[model samples]
Target: MATFRREKCTINITGTNRAVRIAGASGGFSDRQRAISSLARLDVDIIVGDWLSECTMTLHGAQKMENEKLRAEGRLMEQPAGLFDPTFIENLSPALPDIARKSIKVAVNAGACDAKLLARTVENEVKRRGLDLKVAYVEGDEVTDVVNRLIKGGEKFTSLMTGKDLKDWEYTPIYAQCYLGGAGIAEALKNGADIVVCGRVADAAPAVGAGMWWHDWNRDKDFDAIAGGLICGHLIECSAYVTGGYFFGFKRLMDGCANLGFPIAELFADGHCAINKEPDTGGKVSIGTVASQLLYEIQGPLYYGSDVTANIEGVVMTEEGNDLGMTAIGGYQAEFHVYICGLDLEAKAEWVEKQIRHSAGDAAKELSCSKFSLNGYCPDNPRNQDVATCDLRIFVQTKNKKLVDKSTLDVPGFNRWCMDNGLQGCPGWTLGNDQRQSEGKIYYEYYVSLLPQSEVQHRVVFPWLGGNTLDVKPCANMKVYPRDQPSYETSNPVNLKSFGPTTRGPMGWVVGGRSGDKASDANVGFISLLTIPKIQYLLDEEYKGGKIERFEIPGIRAVHFLLRDHLDRGFNSTSTYDTLGKNVCEYLRSKWVDIPNKFLARGRF
Candidate 1:
């Protein structure tokens, strides 16, 4: 048996991006013996290879699209090779070193095809080639869907199922690899596979995979190993996320960028890994950046993976220097993963943009307001409101009646109030039809549900790097969603802001003359302040056949209140009485404005 140790590893290799002799602190395998030989040189036990990523799939899609386009244009291309899975397998074949071929375990987390397919392919190859290649299979699509579903729906929902469900879900069309982690791979290792090829496993999976092998961990075993693996995984998950992709103030450090390198996890049996990278790379390692990356895509305090609940709180990264940092992480509670289903629907129709105009109230100046009431003073008898020239709006949307209806409901009544009250031309209201709705407009929305891994089948046919494989074929399944009348509306800020005659009062409370905070309801208490002023104003104007009532800001044009309502009131109160100025400003500032910006330039209305 070969021995494994925790130490830095150096190997003679060519650079993929730059020409330099870079020593790796950890080792992983492509070819079995090559991996073992590298391990021998490094004296380490495990090696990890990153296979699948969304970015990679997107690149593949783009290439496929280009090939089809060219073929259709009569620009024929050469045939493509049938060396997809073969190349990867052949790459690993050299690992049959004299020391111990069986002892060298291999794993593949790249999912270009189904787990069963990859498993069967490798099995047949090993049998035919007479190589005792022990391999483990991890499904990538499964893990991605599991996490994605959990994020969209909570754990309270019973949408997920067990891994055994794959048997029944083998026929689904998978777009991407469903990811699994170390648990299954570890199980395969214990089951005597010298190598594991997974459909869609996570980048963090290798640590968990190796940990599972070393500890014989079950799904519910000591989660510390899993958690340790998670920490290691977090560091390496993005390949360079921890190194410098999202590094804070990264532009300030020279070593911070020019040559972004991938992360390496020098993992230990204790489940910890010293996060390092290729030497001479252009990036720095520090506590702040690593800590930030650890928090990327995090879920609950109880971090859930397909295999276990990684306790994130226990993981800690400390800064050593500009290019050095230390991570101390452990402790985990195991949790079983849930399987989930998702929809894959295409839009039946789409709405495009069109131009049109409709008239409402002629101008913003048509509005007028008094203490007790408001009037638009329009020349035409305006919509039943006591106000004369109150603003009106004509809204429209794409032919979709449903979306248009919803949009109208969402139109803020506050803008109408401002327009009716002649608060138009308020500093920030710039859109000409600002809040106006149009008629005879159409709209279309596009939506697609990302399917779960079990619902999709991936068939990865890898060709030689920079080499052609198969001849391009025209896609018979090209979908083209036709565009028609755009359902968009021009804003009518003037009329939209002046919906109703009366202004809607701000919501708050008022206390009695001597009422203490505990004794009074602040909301209703506010009714008194406006009520008193309204009554005085009405009475002074002489009960002209109508009741002396305080008018709340009109629901239609509440926006003016949003702009000048509080400002004017506080100004009036402060000017009326110095003692009340501070209290009124303080109160309004606290009660209103959710995301307040002291400076006008800092925030938008």
Candidate 2:
């Protein structure tokens, strides 16, 4: 076998300009490691990886908390606690040769808590390999200490959901990291950083930086271009997401794709980009997938980034008035999961749920939200024990952590409640060895809010410059964007009779969209090709939740719905199997909607 390498990167600087192709090499720290090497072998100019999110941040915070406690108890640790995800080095080391060979620039926010360590590690790897590559680390996303000081200096650190100050939060603050823009990333790439590792830079920041560096785009001078890059970056940051990973039409791709292809954004100087994937890959690149990623985890049309507010006005993103305030149920949450296997699964599930709730006694009444969700049913007949299983999830959210914390003597612990019913449970009763559920280690309230650009102090560390730093300033001429953009005058009427003949079918057959969370609320942007459509949601009696405010974007022929506070205070607190709200779209698609006969005739649901 011979090593394949590109002679040099093909830059598009001539009159007949070509788009700078940036491949989404990694969606997260845990994404397929082969993505970087695989995409680098293709015609990509730059490879960008995203590694931070609220979920990951919470996990990192938990790790820090655990290690602190262990050190306090004078426990011997093998490796000193890592502020950054060490997986970055694991994911990057094998791909560096290909990346360097292809002359492909790279950026990744694998620096969960420490950019310097990861950046230095990558630089050392390059040096050891004798590769001519520049490695830089973007910093200042970590601001826990700064936040604490500011809190004492009269900064409320108000909850974005409740508008209550951090002081009102019953539990002591764990840590805070601010969301940063692409400015720091762009600076690194422009200053000749072949590889840029970052911490807490926005998910799409890698792509945004690549586009800015490739096009020489100034945020203030090129707002639309910047916004365009922002939107493009948003669309492809989730790797295969916009190319059929969470798509409604996933079955169609299952025929050929063993795995979905990582997304690549075809970046142009004008700001607009075309999203595609490597040819012959498992997934597809279509309007449905692109729109699905666009609507993922988004709040409204005015998509605010630290650098610029990218308005999705013409493409039609909007949110009807939300009942969004003080929706955090009890704040602190305690949860436990028990898997039932083999025969009498339902009976076993019932026993666990029943006993867990009953054991709480009087304290159960005080819970803001108590949900016992029976998820995943075992199939009938002819399968192994592993296949014949279902999960019994017990969630308790209350104002006080002690109510859920297993160590507290305040009330009966959820873990104890779950385990005590083991003997009484049905034939398949089982419990996991993980004691954290009982210990209340799985409880945390997630809050999302913005910090000023000045506060973040976005900067880059150049390893080639002997660890010298460069400050990346926010846009000088930033625009004050209005919260609401003009929604297309598409009327979303719920009159089922208006569409003439109707048939009961899964909503998936008629339309496609994406669902994700903005804090606790789930936003599902429903896209349909037809306008003047009459649709109604026929949720059964089992449905119980907050107001679903619906809006329509005639331009894109999409109906957007915000399921206010649907996730039980979002991912960390939510007992739902689909913590990120990624499954909401598919779940809604599975619902039997009154599909117009014309849509059925068209055979494009």
Candidate 3:
């Protein structure tokens, strides 16, 4: 509860080889309490907290708008305070004195969309306790007006995921934010600020900014070092993620990992970093743990950031001893996903494709569609056979963004045409989810793409320092490259009849899997409970020439399949049934796969 008197101070560092140890306190709002504890216990120069995710921003924005509406209607007293993460003040209040006493700087993106307001809240809290913590925030990421102006000027504001213009969207976006880099945070620290809050920055921006401030790294001349810091930021950006929290081998670390410690990175001037956690805290930090995190949600090998692109293709992972994990950094056109449902009983996938082609014309030139039959109509019990209607789901893919958008926009017309031909269709011409089917859902998939660093505006606002702002620019030495696609191999011919007596059951019976969206692509990684050869045989016979491509990570006992052009440009803009790719694995699991009786006899399935 102690507080320090306010003092104006400037941070001046004069060391090239000095190393900075920064801790990632919170991954998101849920980790508030634990994150605060890390600041109290860990010996670090700075603590970086990340509380903003894409979903959190949207939800928080909606809540703020709702509160404003209620206020206008006289539903409450004065407007509620703190539009940023609600728990930010609660978590940081108690630790302010300790942070001040220890002379440690704090940088976080807990501000979400309202950095200035969040900064004011933090400033108020500090003053309430008689503390003089200089709080600063970075702005300019809020691009609603910028977007509107661009749209007015006839700029498409094309989606990076779907490559479609936002002009075609039926509804205007609530807000459009650009992902900023770490230069702003670094600038804030340089100008005597103790705490830096930001809005919608790249997840690792804080770490990168802290590195820049600590080392005085030149933005133009230090591309390698900056890239290195960017990598470090990514490693610990999710707190416990680098410390065995979400490792594929979670079971092995379960005993002590329940209270997993947040991650800290000891970053060198050269950009190399070592990740660890507070002493006596739970969770393991090893090669596997770090590698798992490094690969999480990544698209192609090249990891793009607002400041630098880290090539991870040749990154080496090795163990220093028993507990530490190390990695060496190094350095695509993607596809969109279309989900079609509620087909008439007589409707065939080929017919649906023809109709789509006709509606789309040249737009559907290179597009490919894959059909899936939902044999049962009952959402409550998918296995029930007594349902009156079933659904035909089609997944369409192409590199053409306009074609995808047009196909989606033309769904109503397609449905009308189908209903008109119902009499000529099959005997049991029925459809489910009539309303949703009539309004076709299309998603523009996300893929890793690059933009010039010069285009990004990075700036810091010093609220405590009379609201002055400093601008930061991207490195002049940086080079941008297009993302590469994953190379796929054709499935080896397999004679399923050669395998002994088989049981036709859901694929999940023999395989446990996980699926997620990487930009626009859907990555489904599954482990075989049975032998690899048998699983290979099943995949070869079942998934050949499908939109998915199968590959293996030899280090882990798992097979992963990348569903190219899946998820319709990713979660943000995807209108697909499964926007997050969360259902891909479950749906595949529900599909019947012929399993060898030998494995079933062991009861493993």
Candidate 4:
């Protein structure tokens, strides 16, 4: 049994749950090897290698289909996705080659298994073996089905309910994943499962489950007893992500990071675990980064893992100066297997493209005029279902809407230069608006999983492999493959324009419909105003003299402005308010008219 010695509080963590963190080397094979080696150093009960991804799966499926097609034509089949590489499973068994030596056990929760393929493999193994090796498989998408089935069947939560007892659990599923909580895994272990396999369980589920078994936890207990295991699992779920991948302030933990060994959960039965990496490791574990993650990455108001809802709200942390900050999580509860899942839908795809263009120095004036006349001469097919009315996208760095509007119109005149021009592919002196892709519509798909009637499948293993091969060489690959692009219906017509890259220089502001607006090339001597928009705005304000200078608001960090240059005021200026108070008041009132004085004063505005 694991135990914790707390100095300030009586912390008692109970339950069969544990977790270990592993880190990879570089990107592909090297990373896998490093991860396996890191896992080897841990004393945990189970090892989970997250290799397969949904995107990877899709790519693999497409590759397999393509390979199958080629093989039919007597052509050498191209390698399917990462299937050709053995590093994925190659690293699995090595993570702890001597686990059996220590009488310790480990299980594989296939990262993202093909449900049909895995089920068939298990069934075949069962047929081949008479060994009493207990095997268990957790479906990722069936927890809801299990809960619903229990409700309908009048089965109490306290009692053990198996999938065999459910009548409606036969729903064929594309991906059925149930995040079996630690209690469930403990029950499985108690029932004698030498090896457990699952599909799409939450990253932390297996570690927590293993910890629970190791600790011999009770099912009806409070959550704190399981919080330590839960936290440990969460830390290692993404492997090195916690150690360094996502840590922005990594310089602080550079010492304990030479070898950057994998993390370990020195878990105590009192719901507290000391998070530390392997000795001579090349990773950093500080309180700041971990706290930041706890605040950001965690999903719910209360952090919920397989067996516990760790209310990190009260998780205490202390900074040991440059050393790691010790974390103490308390006050949590377990929601059991009563997770919720909505109806499933089909997948859809979409893409977008953007383009811009402009003309060169002296020839720009003539080209601008040519484009105007050419628009009337030639036009793209106006009648196309997959297209829409094209418009000139006048992109400017200026926040000035007025300048943007003027530029939008200025682009058409660019065609005038095309007249008597020898340039061959010069858009034929046409005023072409850039074509823009439209938004995609909602797509839906039908799905079925053994949710309500699903029961736990237990005890299945084969002969040749034996229970010993729980750490066997698995045929796994992680290299991503490309898939056939899905055909999308262009319901929303795109802009009717020849969409392509353009070549042009910046446009000068038009003054009273005349070019050469200003030659105000005065250098402000400061790099701050070096941007084109700023220089233009400052020059316009100085020459035109109708500039409005806005002030920052009190108690407000940022403010939105509705600015329009080239207004009726002859000389244009930016919108600037003298008193942030009045402008802010008006702004807030416009948005919320019913806001009362007390609310505004209370900073609830």
Q: Which candidate achieves the best TM-score against the true structure?
A: 2
Q: What local lDDT does model 3 show for residue 465?
A: 57
lDDT of 1 at 564: 13
Number of backbone-clashing residue pairs for each candidate, in the order shown: 92, 3, 12, 61
Q: Per-residue lDDT of 279-307 in model 4, one digit per residue for the tens? A: 54566555533432233233222344434
**Candidate that would win on lDDT:** 2
Q: Look at candidate 3 and tell me the lDDT of residue 276.
A: 69
Per-residue CA lDDT of model 2 for 1-605, tens digit only, reads 00111113233455535667888877776777778778878888898888766777777766666677788998849676577876677777787788888789988888887787777777788888888899898888777677667767887656554446667766666667777778788889889888888888778778878878888887667776777777877877888887788777777778756777787777777777777787667777776677677777776556766666665655322111111111122256666778777766666666677777677777676677778777777788837777777777777666655643243322356566777777777777677656565444345667655455656667898877888999887677644433333333244435668779998878888778888877777777878632212222433432344555555555556666655567765767676676887777777677776788977897764
Alpha-carbon runs more than 4 Å astray in model 3: 1-16, 61-81, 168-170, 315-457, 478-480, 483-515, 518-520, 524-565, 568-605
> Which wins on lDDT, candidate 1 or candidate 2?
2
Comparing candidate 3 with candidate 4, which one achieves the higher lDDT? 3
| Weakest lDDT window of 10 consecutive positions for candidate 4 | 510-519
TM-score of 2: 0.82
> Candidate 3, residue 75: CA error in Å?
10
Model 3, position 450: C-alpha lDDT score: 28
* Alpha-carbon local distance difference test for all models: 0.35, 0.69, 0.62, 0.33
